[model samples]
Structure formats: C-alpha cells, structure tokens
Target: MNDQSEQERWNARYADDSYLFGTSPNAFLASQRHLLASGQRALAVADGEGRNGVWLAEQRLHVTAVDFSPAALAKARRLAESRGVEVSFVQADLATWEWKESSFDVVAAIFIQFADPPLREAIFQGIRRTLAPGGLLLLQGYRPEQIQYGTGGPPHAENMYTAAMLREAFRGFEMVSLVEHDSVIQEGAGHHGVSALVDLVARKRA
Candidate 1:
C-alpha cells in the first residue's frame, strides 16, 4: 500500500476504543532507558497511540511524536496529558516527511515495519541524518523467524528485520549493542507473549 492508504488503515485501526498496542512503552526501550541521553531532543517515529513518546517525555527529554494516524495522535496527546508530560505530535508520512538533519539527540523506532526495502533505507538514512553527533538510535522489531511464534508483527517475512539488515542500515555508526533474542513482551493485546526480535543501539559518530 502507498503512504496514504497505509495512513488510512492505521487511522482506522486506532479509531476503536481498544488500545492497539497498549498504553505503555515497549519493553525493549524501557530496558535500555539508562543508555538514553538526558535532557536532549528525541523523536519517536510511527509512534502510534503515543505510549513510547509519552514515556520518553516523562523521562524529561523534549519529544516529538510522529505518526500518520490522527486518531492515534489524539490518543497520544491524551496519554501525555494523563502522564503529566508534554509532547509534540506531528502527523505526517515518514516516507515524505521533511526531516531536519542532525536535529535530534535520540531517535526511537519500535515496531514500525516497512516492507518496502527502498523506503526502509530512506527511513534509516533519515534517522541517521536527523541525529546530532554522538546521538543514539534505539530500534526494535520482530525478526523473520517471528513468523513461527505468531505472537505479533507483520505477516510478510520480508517486512521483518534482522541483525545484518540493521548493521547495514547504520553501517557508519558505532553499534553499542546489537542482538537477536527471544523475550516475553507485554504491551496490551496487540503485542504480548514470547517473541523473537532484533534490538540495536547505534550512536552517530562524533
């Protein structure tokens, strides 16, 4: 699907009363919170329903939450308010969004699956360009092997991620941590139970 169609689909998915991915930060991100630089600007891409973004804002980082779904952004705003934190919500297609170069201290991308290889590259390059020197990129997504688990994630194995793919995606950056492992994720109904995934923490070179 094109960006517009994808946005519509997500918007509809989030229009319901149920929280699609729950109202908490992803387990992997929460685990690595200490590695995040304090008091720095951060961007959460495809931050549907604002769980992760709100969590980051609570940690005192200036946060910009970007997602294509207005419904999701609305819920994200509500979440930030309830958490007594502030976050900027931007509605735009990441594929065509005008990202400012070297603008963020951290970029958080969790479970934003991009099956299109070229778009994935563009998104990764955008993440690299949008980070300040020595900035961090925290990424987590299901591995292709996740198909067997059927706990969550995109149906197409091609949309899944691998360590090698992430290594190439941030080829020039310093990889602080990279691993493919199994973990029991609990993030509401959409994402829960045991799953195989890839997690990476790469820093932009100074």
Candidate 2:
C-alpha cells in the first residue's frame, strides 16, 4: 500500500471513539516486566493507541512510541497523560525511519506486521541496531496460520510470522525465550479471539 493510503487506513482505525486495543498492556509484555530495568531508554515500535508505550512508561522506561498514524500517536499521548506518566510519540514510517544506533535499552515490537518480507527485515534490523548492547527485544506477532483462526491480523499470509522466520531475523540475540502457541487474546476489537501466536524475548550480545 502507498504511504497515503496506509496512513489514512490506520488513522481511521484509531479514529474510533474507543481505543481499538484497550488501555491495558499486552499480556506477553506485562508478564515479562521482571526483565525491564528502571529508567532505561525504550522504544515502542508501531505502538498503536499507546497502551504498550504507556505501560512501559509506568515501568520507568523513557519511552519513544513511533507509528505512521498520527491518530494513533495522538491516542498514545492521551493515554500517557491519563496515566500521569509521559512518553514521546513520533510519527514516522518504520520502513524508512532513520533508526539511530544503540539508542535504546529496550525495544518493544508487539504486533507490528504491516511490512512485507523485504521491509520486515529492514524493520527488524533497524530495531537490532537501535538497541544498546545487552538490551532486550520483546516481540510478538501472529503466525501465518492465523489466517485459519478467522480473527484479527492481516489477511495476507506474507504479513504473518513463523518461528524460523523470526529466529533468522533476530538470530544473534541471546536466545532467552521463544514460543509458538495457541492462545486467546482479547486486547480489543482490533485483536481478539484464539490465535496462532509467536512470543519472543531476547537480549543483544554485549
């Protein structure tokens, strides 16, 4: 999809009066809170509606939430204010964003599967480069089998993930944990129902 169309699509998705994905953090991300350190620099890639980003701020991470949708970023800002915490939200396309080197101690890449295969590698590499050594990468996405679930996520299988796909995409990280399973996710109207999922948490080599 072209930039304008993609932007408009996401804008409409977030334009809803209710947050598409409730204000709560992702279960996978919240469960791994013990891995986060206080006051670390963090980045929330494609953080729609700011739930994850706001949650990270609550954990004391200085967070920068980046997304192509202005409406989404606006919602994220409101979420931060409502929580009495703060986070920086940037409007930019991950496909071409100049991801700085070793800038963040943590990178949250939950459910950002908009990119195609080629762009997917670029996004993953950018996140890898953006993380400081020993930093953690927390990610979760729908597997290609999600198409069978008839739930949320892109209809295209190419936009979906697989264990081998992510393993190769982020190979050098210390293999902390990676799981592929079936689970019921009830984030909101955007993402709900039993789905094929992949959850990963790994650390960059020091």
Candidate 3:
C-alpha cells in the first residue's frame, strides 16, 4: 500500500475511543527493566497510542515516539498527559522517516509486524543505524505459527518473525538474547489468545 493508504488503514483501526493494544507496555519490554536507566535516549518505533513510549518516559528515558497515524498519535498524547509523562510524539511514515544515526541508547520495537519483507528490511536497517554504540534493541513480534492461532499481527506469514530471521536481520549486533515460545497474552482487544511469539534483545558493539 501507498503511504496515504497505510495511514488511512491504521487511522481507521485506531478511530475508536478505546486503545486497540491497551494501555500497558508489551510484556517482553516491561520485563527488560534491568536494562533501562534514567537519562537514556530511547525511541519507540510505531508506538501506537503511546503505551510503550509513555512507559519509557516513566522510566526516566527521554523518549521519541513515532507513528504514521494521526488518530493514534492523538490518543498517545492524551495517554502520556494522563500518565503524567512527557514523550515526543512524531507523525511520520517509518518507511521514509529519517533514522538518525547513533542517536538513541535504547530502541523498543514491539509487535510492529505491519511491514512486508521490503519495508521490514528497511526498518531493521533503520534500527541498526539509529542505535548508539552499545545501545540496546528490544523487539518482539509474532511468529508464523501465529497465523494458525489467528491472534494478533498480520495474516501474512511473511510478516512474522523467526529467530533465524532476526539473527540475520540484526546480524552484527551482539545478540544479547533471542527466544521463541507460545503464550497466552491479553493486550487489549488487538492481541489476545494463545500466541506464537519471538523476542529479541540485541546490543550494538561499543
């Protein structure tokens, strides 16, 4: 889809008053509290409704949340305000967003499975280029098995993640950790049920 169509599709998904993905941070992200510290510069990619970005701000990280949907960004702003946290909300298409180099200390990419193979590759490259030396990349996504489960994420199996895919995508990263598993997750109406998931935590070399 074109940029406008993509934005329209997501805006429609987020048009409702309620958050599609709920207000809490992703489970994998929240579990990595040990890696977070005050004053770190963080980027929350495709941070719809600000849940992850706001949580990062609450952790005292300077956060910049980027999404393509204006509707979602509006809700995110309200969420951040209500939570008494500050997050820089930017509405930009990730496919074209300037992924500044060596800018962020931590990059959180949770459940961003909208991209097809080509766009996914761009995003993977963007994440690598944007991270500062020794930076942390915390990402989680549904695996191909999720298609059978009929849970969250795109129906296209190509959009799903695998350990091998992630390892190759972030090839030069330190590969802090990577795992695949099945779990029942309830993250609002968007993601709920026994799901196939993969989690990756990689760090840039200093």
Clashes of 2: 0
Question: Model 3, 61-135: lDDT tens per residue?
Answer: 999999999999999999999999999999999988999999999999999999889999999999999999999
Ranking by lDDT: 3, 2, 1
In the order shown, the candidates' Cα RMSDs to the true structure are 1.2, 0.8, 0.7
Per-model CA lDDT versus the true structure: 0.89, 0.92, 0.95
Measured against the true structure, the TM-scores of the candidates, in listed sequence, are: 0.96, 0.98, 0.98
Ranking by TM-score: 3, 2, 1
Query: What are the per-residue Cα lDDT tens digits for candidate 2 across 97-157?
Result: 9999999999999998878888888999998899999999999999999999978888889
Worst 10 residues of 1 by lDDT: 113-122
Please give the distance, in angstroms, between residue 54's alpha carbon in candidate 1 and its true position after superposition. Answer: 0.3
lDDT (tens digit, per residue) of candidate 1 on 3-35:
678778888889987788899899889988898
